[model samples]
Target: MSVFTAVTEDDLARWLGDYAVGRLVSFEGIAAGVQNSNFFVTTTLGRYVLTLFETVARADLPYYLHLTAHLAHHGLPVPAPVADRNNEYLGTLSGRPAALVRRLSGRWLTDPTPAHCTRVGAMLAGLHLAGQSYGRRQPHPRGAQWRAEVAERVLPHVGAEDAELLRTELAWQAQQDFDALPQGVIHADLFRDNVLWDGELIGGVIDFYFAGTDTLLFDLAVTVNDWCTMADGSLDAARSAALLEAYGDERAYTEHERRLWPAALRAAALRFWLSRIEDLHLPRSGEMVQVKDPNEYRRILVARIDGEARLPDRP
Candidate 1:
């Protein structure tokens, strides 16, 4: 129930006239995401998801929409934007930039198997390969520079132990040679919920808002941290192995990426931990919102720091 903007039936019906999506049969606010105002829109033609960008700048939106369209065109399972008569993928509704995309089938798997991880790994590599010629360049918004800035902002609110840990981790990450690793467009946030599954196959990889240019290993780190973790925040060795092996089959990991894998995992955990803490103390308002527990990533970060979870050796 994270719909921040309300769209009345009359307003939506009028909006539908611009696109050839047929008459509006029904529409309701989607409750899953925390960023945009999403609705499950049904029309006489097909089912689609309409999203109203809330925090995203109107000018910066073309990168996301066009990236999605490009990925879909390159045979990846992504939500392609539904264009209006003018061949424009973006429009305005409820005083916010909006766009419609075909709704994908299947549900997110809460309890994922190694097979599922394998599928995600392969598809992620495919996504990176597909974006080799994407043209547009958007740096990772939550990269090291932003993380350092936000750490100072959130330090005053956290406990002394947490603050010290944050400083140490950030300083260590800053010293790493991430430039040597392979670089490409990455889904910076590839949490389980963002991926849709039809049985063991990935129906689609949704939520491209956080995507940007970064080391390929960082992207893999983000995926493994969430998708390959057990309940106790420990990395599941089998699942991690499956993911890395499958990913390597598509795009072989460079020796540099392999060497920096551990640091990348640490960086991924720290990124989420800092962002979650900020979200908890400095909150944002939305029509319907749910704040995730910062402690979850804190536990994952601590585990990574303790050298308890290591990715399986490159196959």
Candidate 2:
């Protein structure tokens, strides 16, 4: 389950009717994601993941479907979408596009250690290397583009006392001179919940809704912040090292990328802060959802930039 929502057996049966793979016997809501409603469906034949689109643009799905197929073809650990009887991978359900994916058999670790971080880091590197050859794809604009929403939607919702701090930081960041890092197809969001584990090993990755064309190092920086940023808003050096080393082993960082790490980390944190704040103010009904605290990421970013936190070594 990816989101905190409900899915009934009848809903699954109706959705699975178009598919020839199996007859749906049971279904359950998946509670791990915050974007769309998800269900773990079991059939006479096998298990599959059924997602009911919430706020996602149907136009944006081709990138996810094609990207997952491309990575799977390259032997990376990604879920493959199953086709219906008409050979279509996407189908309409309750006025939304839905798809059934082969269920990856694994458990999501509630508490991930450094070892899990290392494996996930390696998996991310392999996923990126395999996707380097994929056809060009673009990110869909957030319901509001990052800039306008950050200043308008997000700022108005934050408490007045904390608003000035974010405002100051945002203003400073906007004026900073920085170089554009390397560009590629990037999995911009790689949270631990998106990774599936079997015992102590990483089984596979899921959720490609945030995949897009962006600075490659920027994507790595996002992963670092999500997987290695600590509860106290500091970098977990040991975990960060494991992930960065794993990523560097696949595609060694250029001197430019190395130099941009600090800035990129801050930028990534700001991006999530804006997105989470936006979501908090505009909650969607019937969508499996949660409100993330943007302040946590902001604290981590400030600490890193202020030299109070240690950064991972450059390779």
Candidate 3:
């Protein structure tokens, strides 16, 4: 999350009174992502992550926060939302919905190896399995409908060739069917930045705001698009193979899922491309908002369509 909304130390201290998280020793605005306002909060007792929801509806917060708790209860490395003295996981701070999660150890990787991909894949598989019982049903926000809407909003601002590509890709995505594929809760944004690493092991996974009910394969595709892609946005065979095989070892891939892997990869790429384009064309004012390059995912979409992205042969 980004620093769209400013949370002054005094503002945070007043909010801290609602929780038993100890006195706020210090806090600072986090300046990385684009969805919400985030800060690193340190207290005498412990450290925590403070988040202020920007665009998410208030009622919808529980589905995401509770799903994180559910995964945590299942022994996943997700950060569980910390409840206040009233045992509430959500509150209002600086006129926005706010939350606290115990700060987790480890740092995110900039350049992950095949071994790292293997660990991420296994953890993702475990997440899918554990998510089966969450029993909540929030639709994936970046589905086909959202793609079309975002594409419509962004098309006029792009070049003719790029616009044509977006149109054709959206049509291709609409024709696909995932009814036969395994479906469950998915971390719709499991990019490298969302995961924390301690040595060779995964120590933490954050940013569950994008988690939702969707094809599990789509989740895997999203991870692969970010974690296993080269500078030109083509998949690295060794890294992708390590990840796919590791995931398959934990949870077998269905024949249908296997057949649709390439399409899933393309779909995942398009999702990010559309969002990035929107962010670039229709940016909002914020303190630490990162407006990413839409072309990054555009290259990925092209690579997937060119067959550079392939799921490993199922064992």
Candidate 4:
């Protein structure tokens, strides 16, 4: 959520006239994320987040917008798209695909407690269940195929050790069979920054652009890798257990999922590591671009590879 396309007050005021969100009162560009141009917009009716697609193709926009709406309609706390007077969710603004979603209250939790992890775990499981009936079928955007393609682009910039790790992991992940695992629509990027919390309770989950159809275990792995880690990239056992426990209460993990947990954690780490490397070396131009450190996930990948951090067996 950075400023790639600038929207002036006058420009936005004109655009808002086409919608029933009331007149635009004030608007400011958000600078917390690396993808897309986001603005915190306030109108006579309520506060909202206006997003202009920067890199995502216009044709792929409907899957994300409607998926969010579906989850929200099922009582999941997510940002549902606001339809215009014509009852359309997609629109052209500033020559880019744009959308407006009701802004969820609360700030992101930077330093979370085990209680916070538990809440997010349960909410994520509920989200997965709610999305089972969604008719869309998009593959995980950052899955093994994407990682393999991106690895070729980033290998030139990394050291020999990092390059070897990338190649080895890509090949290993390719050989693994995930077809036996339960699959569904997943919030593939459910990092702490993407979830909002009012104190210990989850306010809402935001940023569904990365959501897609994937194994439920893979989604849990992506979440635990971020929410249950220490600064040194070591897994926090108590928090990880809490998260897994809460999630299991909603939908119990199958034996296959439990057996693949270790590998799934490594795959999640590799996905983010590869993406951060791409962003650092092959960045897109934006007024407020944020290039995160690839080494952070690199360390995490190494930790998952070297350490024995496994979820406890179901009781």
Predictions in order: lDDT = 0.88, 0.74, 0.91, 0.90
Candidate 3 is scored at a TM of: 0.98
Question: Which wins on TM-score, candidate 2 or candidate 4?
Answer: 4
Q: Between prediction 2 and prediction 4, which has the larger lDDT?
A: 4
Angstrom error of the Cα, residue 106, model 1: value is: 0.7
Candidate 2 displacement at residue 252 in angstroms:
0.7
Each candidate structure's TM-score, on Cα atoms with residue i matched to residue i, is 0.96, 0.90, 0.98, 0.98
The lDDT, on a scale of 0 to 1, for candidate 4 is 0.90
Residue-level lDDT of model 2, residues 1-315, one tens digit each, is 345345556766777788986787777777665688787778999988888777668878877888888898998778898888888788887667888888886877766778887888788888878878999577624311464456576667788865886677677666544436667777777887788888887777888887887777777878888888777767777888888887787788877777667777777777777777676687665444557776777687676667443234555
Name the 10 consecutive residues with the lowest summed lDDT in model 2. Answer: 140-149
Q: Write the per-residue lDDT of candidate 4 for residues 168-247, one digit (tens) a residue.
A: 98888787777788999999999999998876778889999888888888899999999998888988988898898999
Pull out the clashing pairs in model 4.
none
Best by lDDT: 3
TM-score of 1: 0.96
**Per-residue error at 282 for model 1, in Å?**
1.0
Alpha-carbon shift of residue 190 in model 2 (angstroms):
0.5
TM-score, candidate 4, is: 0.98
Candidate 4, residue 208: the lDDT equals 92
Tens-digit per-residue lDDT, 218-291, candidate 1: 89999999998877778898898899888889998777776788899999999999988998898778778777
Q: Report clash pairs, candidate 3.
A: none
Ranking by TM-score: 3, 4, 1, 2
